[model samples]
Target: MGCFEDLSDQELITAAKGGSDTCFGELVDRHTTTAYRVARSITGSHEEAEDVVQESFLRAFKNLDRFDGSKSTFKTWLLTITRNQSINIVSSFRRRALKFFSDHEEGEPELEFASNPLSQEPLDAETQLSLKRQYHTMDKALKKLPERQRTALLLRSQESLSYDEIATVMDISVSSVESLIFRARKKIIELVER
Candidate 1:
């Protein structure tokens, strides 16, 4: 029943912490798919999403008593943990991969494409496959943004969290979140709608 949806998040948290396994499972069931989407978007891998969700719940359960209902909501807390874990895992993998390449290429000079000798029209490749590739490519480009803008965009767009909730999770001023998200949206719209 969507009756569970009718309950406030704090209500769910209390029920779950009061030894209601059903409530906790309900919470997980309600959120897991969305959590995985958030993780996958952050980490850019399905396997990492699976691992992040599993690890996030494990950590959350262990610290159940540490949760105080007053501050951040349960969803934000769980999502924050999941997102952080995914970013750490992805960043670590990138660092190791870069180091491997660096060690292997010690003697070779890096290669660069000299500015296209001919400035040909770059638009011809917007084929059917290219249309499908656009959003995914744009998401990675979003990661190239500054940290606060990226975080703000992901939470709002992927998790559907409100700006106040995002501000609390990010420990930033509400105005700052608003501004970051505004700038992020402008940049994404500029790229995607083009």
Candidate 2:
């Protein structure tokens, strides 16, 4: 375990492919946080994100041999898998929700963000209230974005991935990533201002 801790992701992948379970475990430990964050960004629910991450890792482990370092780094590849799994789960959930709602003659289900605990920093009540309002507004604006634009923005802003890494994860050209993010930001500002 100590030796595995010092190895790079590529090294871990090679060892894992050679039948080292510990190496694969190390890889999971290294990327689980990022994978969970990516999943949560898409699914917008902690429980769903956890399930998505678990299923993604299982699929990645099963298909380890198909990974090619020449095409993308392990993190990028794993995130791609996480993103696809999250989308699939979200789509499935939406389909089920729509069917159930239609049968019951109920309106569409609304997704709500879990309220954040108050900040530890000392702040006036008015300031805190204003911040919460701003957060809610921003969240609504984000939800209004097209899927690709929102994905590109979240990958860059939340995960702090480089343009090249984002391009690989999203399977788009670097220019396309740039365009998507730009449009996303512009749309967010427009929505927020109104």
Candidate 3:
């Protein structure tokens, strides 16, 4: 039972690209959890997140030859795929939301967001139930926010991305990321407390 612990990201990547399946498997094992979190944050669905993670890895494998270690770290490159896939998954769900909205209107209850917005988290069962109800209200409050504000909150709060990472994902400057997060937090407090 040997470990691949001695290998560098580039070495592992090279081995995987050269058809060493174990190297690829090791990479998958190493990254799956992080990939899943990214997927879950964006899609707000565990099942969809699983699919996104799988698809992200597949896309990464297929494109491995094009990966240049100098331009971006391997982790960042793989995570880019994860983020993109999650975004696509969420976009599809948004389409479904629009379709449902079209089919039913004033009487249609707002769908409970799959992601709960608040929590110092790792809540107990009783707390989860209590917060789940509050989250429904919080979610509605969050919806009133402008698009960038909502996105900033989700990326920052749920995804736990740093400002630079957010800038990378949002294609914005770091200072803009800070402004977006601040505006979102202020709006959230205003809305939730109303």
Per-candidate TM equals 0.70, 0.77, 0.63
Error of 1 at 121 (Å): 40
Q: What is the lDDT of residue 136 in candidate 3?
A: 69
Clash-forming residue pairs, model 2 = none
lDDT score for residue 1 of model 3: 26
Off by over 4 Å in 1: 1-7, 93-95, 98-134
Per-residue lDDT of candidate 3, residues 26-99 (tens digit): 88887897777666556555677788999999999999999988766566677778878777766686757866
* lDDT score for candidate 1 against the true structure: 0.73
**Candidate 2 C-alpha error for residue 105, in Å:** 18
Candidate 2 residues 1-194, lDDT tens each? 33457899999898889988889999999999889878876876677788899999999999999999999999999999999998888789685786677764333233333344575456666776777787668768887887789889988987789999999999989999999999999999899888
Q: Rank the candidates by TM-score, best first.
A: 2, 1, 3
- The TM-score obtained by model 2 is 0.77
Poorest stretch of ten by lDDT in candidate 2? 105-114
